[model samples]
Target: MAMSKFWWKSDSSKDKSIHWMCWSRLTAAKCKGGMGFKNLRDFNTALLGNQAWRLISFPDKLLNWDPTLSYIWRSVMEAQALLVQGISCCIGNGQTVDITNSPWLPSIEDPFVHSDNKAISNQKVISLFKIDEKAWDIELVLDVFEERDAELILSIPLTENDKDTWYWRHEKMGHYSVKSGYNVIQASKNQPNTVDNSRFWRKLWNLKIPNKARRIQVNAQCPVCNLCDESAIHSLVTFSFAVECHQFSSVKQVAGDYHIFTEWLQMVFEQSNNRDICIQEDGLEQWCPTSSNSVKVNVDAALFTDPNRYNYAIVVRDHLGHLVQAMSKCSLGKVVSRAIRECRHQRSP
Candidate 1:
């Protein structure tokens, strides 16, 4: 948070106070309702955690260096402390784990702590199990721990040769990343999300009120229908021209069944591969084909005049002119790499 203050100070000489929302609020998504800025403190923490994640993820891949060579190794050891809460050990061979001392146990509550004084020093967790039977030594576990702890420990799977590995529990897959870790940390906070983005869709549906004319003092009414009091429902359904369009194409649309414009449009437009759209492709440039075996990405940023918001759309296509992926999202934060990364995730399976 101090870092945020320092940057704000450096950016201005006078009138330094941010006129809009505070830095924290601005970090929220516009749909959840804020101006959309990155929370620096959380972001920095995630980045540092990611660095530590890399070190642990590939133990053999780490570079060898002496403490006299650099202070980087010391920094990593310090950062590992923050990551402890979010990660857990995936018991593989279970050799490296100290059963009583390690956080490798699953139970979150402080139930029972087994006396490790009599236990053999550096004893592998596998020693408590019956290897021949491929099962936990239930009698021994019960002696060492309460029933709850015993059951949890018994559930852990072990292999003869596989080494114990780290598991980042935050993600569905056990993979760890700074962006995903950042989002996971952010989700832990119990922030109230009061904004309803669908209200804007409702606004779009009630176009009978002439939103453009009222807001801009200009008469921007429905051009195709030519109705003096044209609404989204009337323009898309009830208009004589629209009924003619439906007649021309064999499709049934029950008027007044859809209260929201988006739902109604989805019903109309969602065909397997065949779709017809009336909206014009404004400001679209000519398309150019890519080399064979290459994927083509097309991206565009748009502004909504009424709500006064910015959004971006990403579409991926194969060289054969087939659509591979399409994604549209409200611009949450500024980073081109983040935008492209999200696009790839949304790409067609």
Candidate 2:
């Protein structure tokens, strides 16, 4: 509450200030048209959930904990449910996975089977596979499960040699991350928001201005209008001067009445003509020739996250701009061979 007070009121000291927006709205993702603020409770649960994921994924690395375990471990155990909500198992041999009990489907939202067939109640996932081939038995799957469930089951890729492994459903790399866990918690809360404003927030934040100018000083009465309370929304949207400025712009007129500053700004952006856009190119640097006897060394670097490596190249050129000495290397483990192969492939085209 105190944090929210500070965020909303820049000049707030002793006197009470009006809360124009709720804390939940303020904490919503910037994409969802709110200031992206971390919900501490949800974030804490996500952090604990990471510990829970480690226990579930690599149980050998952590010590076995009973009721005698520390409070922190107990808290992490409590957040196991939160971790469970965002993770699923990638099907492999399918021998150990229970068809109905295990979350081994390709889909993230509904991984568990909803089938109530008592005959296959205790059956394993292996039973759904074809007897002769390693693929799913199409006829048996269609007859046993619903159309949606059958499709999801069939879509799951199975590695005949590998064992079933747990994976984070939200991540493309199938790794449990704190960021993905926090987003999952945020989604579960079901915030009522429509239309993404991430681009709007980005542009607004990117405006070339001092950081202090972004903070609004709340005033009891508008200095210009001297009619109502001075807030960002009121000053920017409801004020006569602002409306007149909008009206005079290429936008022609204020499209509609808007109480929120963000909504008004978004509407203006949507209604504005793209043809009226004026591009201001920054001053470009002119290339200067090297000294008659001196050589210039040009360097370039590329970073790759897949293998966690960096590749750099250095070229020494004489005053004539002809390459004299060229050298390149890959760092952070010996991925130089792979980097060379990729660079050749890219350079070929």
Candidate 3:
């Protein structure tokens, strides 16, 4: 029967004929009522791939990879040697060598080679060598040198109050290096480039704090009460006014039908707590009067004694309008017929 249904002709199957319609509502961007389809799982994977590539490439500034010293070591060693010679001459010349004067040296404890009457002393030379080693360590070099996306780096010239300030901005643009120094580089698809300086200037000029402040102030007011002090929890749970809203009343009315069985059970338990209720050995549904100034609740055994009969459970309420007790007959089966009646009773009337 199930196999036959697979090939069964139906009006619903006509729409499912096209695979694109299964995922989306339209076909093309310009088409009226055309649904755009997107595979969320594939989109998520692609986004994650871009992030992973970014992490591996830009390990220097983003990951704090200090390659400044290493790059200098490979390309500008001669310049560094000249700087060292200048430092040595400055210290050797009779000018008082205050360790604080040298920018190359990181600390005051750095040792210097003092020339004793033109010839360099061996002890002072060794101290100078030690200081040089320590200075090299302070240059900030990374252990590993991995090439990163160059185009991702760019310098943005920002002006606040007619002051020129350049800021570095890095972002992934596939395989391209987005550095600010390159004039040939094109701006992002949505972003305006240097060629459109007029639009860019307008955007920068319109960037006022009051606009953002206005937006924040608009959303700052509570949706429920229009009060600034009203919060999410206050609107949903604690607010007495919120509970009186029409929406809450409508929701409660809809929920009442779904919780009928559970609500009835609760009422029964509450009633039994304050009143006397009796359960017959044979399952039956009945009511009896009590004498302890409590609501009376009783059950007859005939309801369950019949082997092929189905009976409904009864709920009893107290004078205070609270549910006081409930009783139900056992199932019409042999297991319950011989088993002791297990009637859970409570009183909270």
Candidate 4:
């Protein structure tokens, strides 16, 4: 209620204002037309669940706790139920997973085997694997289960030497994240996503405007132009300096008269040429070799415009500067800076 009130109420006003949308809708994802505001309760639960995930994933680090323990530890332990709902066992050796009860399939929805066979209900996932071949026993799988169940079981890849481990089903990399946990909680409510303005949002975010120009300023009146209000559109498009920049830039004739900022941005994007700009600073340090007995890894990535692909290469070298391994791959996707952010977040304590 406090969050909702703060969102709807103005800084200058103490009087209550009408909330334009329900709290649930307001907290929905931006693609769904809401502002992507986090529901504090759900967010708090998700955070606690992340701590619980750490406890489960690293049981060795766990300490004995009771009602007398710290409030934070007790709260995290209580959120184990929330974490359990969104986690599934990734099939490794599959020795510990129950065939009927365990969630071991390569799926998020209905991960458990949907089988009526009373005979295999109590069996473990290892029973489905060929003992000698380190692979799924195809004949036994086909004969013992229904078609869908059989197919799902066959689709699961196994690492014969590795032990079964629980993973977050909401993420592709099988890693638990607070955002994914929150999404799982949201999914349980069966909230309908009415709008999908993802394309518009993506384009708006991908605009090549500078950070200083993108941010909203307190004063609306243009300090330089004096004739119009200063906004993203005005500063980036209509201001005299911006006009001069466009004239000087490779994109020689960008118009500032478009009715909407998106249209103007779209025009700028469409008309813009793929011109590479490089700035080199003096006194930049060069790569140095690692310490003795250690190996160093370096990775570089490039974004290609014509085919919309990201190509990356990784190289590993020993302390002696001898090449250990080198590999490169190309993938079709948006820029991978988001992955970098995820990696940083996951590594945070």
Tell me the alpha-carbon RMSD of every candidate: 22.5, 21.2, 26.8, 21.7
lDDT for each residue of candidate 3 in 1-349, tens digit (9 for 90 to 100):
2222333435688544434343323221212232323334333333433333344345353432355645423332322322222122112221233322232221222323121232222222122222423221111111111112111111111122222111112222223122221211111112444233455545554566554343333465554334435555445433444445523332231222222445543544554543344455687534444444566443345444457555656666664546787877655643343112211111112
Looking at model 2, residue 80 earns an lDDT score of: 76
**Residue pairs clashing, model 2:** none
Off by over 4 Å in 1: 1-14, 28-36, 62-71, 74-78, 107-123, 131-134, 187-349
**Winner by TM-score between candidate 3 and candidate 2:** 2
Question: Which regions in candidate 2 have their CA more than 4 angstroms from the true location?
Answer: 1-21, 62-64, 67-69, 192-199, 214-349
The whole-model lDDT of each prediction reads 0.65, 0.77, 0.33, 0.78
Collision pairs in model 4: none
TM-scores, in order shown? 0.44, 0.55, 0.14, 0.52
List residue ranges in candidate 4 displaced over 4 A. 65-74, 192-349
Query: What is the TM-score of candidate 1?
Result: 0.44
* Pairwise TM-score winner, candidates 2 and 4: 2
Model 4 earns a TM-score of 0.52
- Across residues 231-348, which tens digit of lDDT does each residue of candidate 2 receive? 8987766666666665655444447877787877777677776765333347443445798999998887887876888899998989988889999998874344443454356547
Better of 1 and 3 by lDDT: 1
Candidate 1, residues 46-131, lDDT tens digits: the string is 78788778878877765645656657765555546457656777677667877766667664333223555466346767787686
Error of 3 at 194 (Å): 25
* Ranked by lDDT, top first: 4, 2, 1, 3
The candidate, 1 or 4, that scores higher on lDDT is 4
The alpha-carbon root-mean-square deviation between model 1 and the true structure, to one decimal in Å, is 22.5
